[model samples]
Target: MQRSRDGRCKCLSKVGLSWKGSVDEDVVELVQPLTGREQFFTASSCAGCIILLDGGINGFEVQKQNRCWLLVTHKLYVKDDVIVALKKANGGAVLKFEPLVLHVQRQQLQDAQILHSVAIDSAFRNSGIIVGKRGKTVLAVQSTHGLEVPLSHKGKLMVTEEYTDFLLKISKSKNGGKQEEN
Candidate 1:
């Protein structure tokens, strides 16, 4: 399953993928659980748009009739119907989906306002998430192993020098056998 930029929950259904409000979304009628491949991916139709979920990939590609389209990189273990979890990189957790679907739109492909990014955390290197948004800024989650560094997008788009010192202090404290928030 996938969570849209507006926090809506999306899942596959008999008719296709369906979206409901954030907390009330359900995939009971949308997806059938099966074995084989165990990963999920979701993305829109664009040149570099790709969401690598679970152990599979889902996104869009060009077709004869459609200028831009969504496509899945089929794996040998993949089956027709299955439910999988969608993982995001950068220390975020996974989002579950029953079945995955690809959606395409001409405007989505040509729009330059779209933001596509892939985040992979050092702790969860094996798991990653791809996000697509029109005008949303991605927030970095609090790091359990390192200091909480704040990144600003405005101005020079750089982290404060004090943040680096804070990280060093945190590291030193850890090595000195003390527990403190760096």
Candidate 2:
């Protein structure tokens, strides 16, 4: 048998959890279970995080104001884990919370569809699918729960815990089910 030129292991490369940089523990714990399965793999992910920048969008330059992913995950995951990950957000130039965002790569279209259904069940909305550069079908999963607050207010964080909690409640209520008018 002729050996293949590609050195990467097909089995391991397409069926494991991977990250671009450091990730939150909560996210890791949440994703670990999925990576063990045969049909999916995580490419990049973030359990919604917060960041601050010195220069405001209004063009004011200060110290070290920049956005950072408090948490990131690149795999199939439960949307609630993103909100729960926010528990790690504390004491920084913390400005806002970005809801859980995931990029999952599936073995094929059917796999993508299955994951999409799973995402919907987990309260994730705005689910989309695309063929990756490597010819893999990838699913973009998202939760509507997120926040962007003006950190320019006296160089301090204007976002409050109450506001984030409210966003979470709204997001949870909107999960793939029917909405009720108040």
Candidate 1 C-alpha lDDT tens digits along 1-182: 34456544332321232132111123222222210112222222111112122211123221223211122222211212111211112221111211222231112332211211221332312222223576222222111232222222211213334543344344434323353453
lDDT by residue (65-177, candidate 2, tens digit) is 35434443322232355445444444332334456767776677988888889888877876788886778787888876654443324344445655544544443343322
Which TM-score value belongs to model 2?
0.53
- The whole-model C-alpha lDDT of candidate 1 against the native structure comes to 0.24
Score each candidate by Cα lDDT: 0.24, 0.52
Candidate 1 error regions (>4 Å): 1-145, 154-159, 177-182
Q: Candidate 2: where is the Cα deviation over 4 Å? A: 1-23, 56-94, 153-182
Top-lDDT candidate index: 2
